[model samples]
Target: MNLDELRTIMRQCGVEDGVDLDGDILDLEWQELGYDSLAVLEITTAVQHAARTPLLEEEVALLTTPRLLLERLGTLTPAAV
Candidate 1:
């Protein structure tokens, strides 16, 4: 998904206005933005629902930043038989 979509998902997940949306946040950790495990789960759930991609809980757990999460989502493709 695109950055706009990710931003929307984050906003829906209760990210405050204090968080910089336009600035570079790729290196920032989710916890640094005040997101706990539950918040991450909520964001991942919303992303999965929007993207119609099946994401594992472990995969979600490993996503430390928005860039990583976006990259992981970008790599999701249907397997061919």
Candidate 2:
């Protein structure tokens, strides 16, 4: 997970051109991305497949933008038990 990966994931998520990914996702509403609940769910499914992990429903809800989503996923790095 890097910015490039985040951009790609967002492209897959249907983010239109001209939207900025450098800002806070929460500041951008769902309507800005042209997404409804179903589209967001589809993006969650795509991210799960791409990342090859199970993302909790709550986690998906927090993915309002590419940057934020990647940041959250980056925090999931495996640690020694």
Candidate 3:
């Protein structure tokens, strides 16, 4: 999904900062955005659900920023999921 939608998912996953999420935050690391590894995994799962796409585990492991995740998701079609 898009960044705004991602922001929503991040919130639901317990990233408790609207100010950070509202800013130009695409490039921020997950840690800097108030998420740990566990939370990141949760976020990835939520993203896949929201997008109706299956992300590769290796690719998910490589994700560092919201932009990167979005880019990865963009490469997949529903059929590819």
Candidate 4:
């Protein structure tokens, strides 16, 4: 999924809380973004809905940031430097 899709999920999950999701936030930790474990669960649930792939708990725990989450979901294309 892309940032826009993730943003949509976050908004739908009631998670972002006004943070500038459009900003450079891919590297920010979910905790830094004010997301707790429950929030993370919510996010994963939303991702599962969109991707139609259920994440194992162990796998879900590894998604620490937006970039990591996108990578784990196997949705992010490598960026050109």
Candidates ranked by TM-score: 4, 3, 1, 2
The CA-based lDDT of model 3 is what? 0.83
Kindly report which residue stretches of model 3 are placed more than 4 angstroms away from their true locations once superposed.
16-19, 75-81
Residue range 1-81, candidate 3, lDDT tens digits: 887799899988886645478887777899888899999999999999989999888889888988888888884233232
- In order of appearance, the predictions have TM-scores of 0.82, 0.56, 0.84, 0.84
Off by more than 4 A, model 1: 75-81
**Model 3 Cα displacement at 40 (Å)?**
0.4
* lDDT tens readout by residue for model 2, 1-81: 555554566667776677765554443556676677887788667777777767888888877755456556674333311
Q: Choose 1 or 3, whichever is better by lDDT.
A: 3
Q: Give the TM-score of candidate 4.
A: 0.84
Candidate 1 local lDDT, 11-76, one digit each (tens): 878876588766776658898877888998898889888888888888888888887787778842
After TM-score superposition, the amount by which residue 17's alpha carbon in candidate 2 deviates from its true location, in angstroms, is 7.5
Q: Write the per-residue lDDT of candidate 4 for residues 1-62, one digit (tens) a residue.
A: 77789978877766556787778778889888778899889998888889887788998888
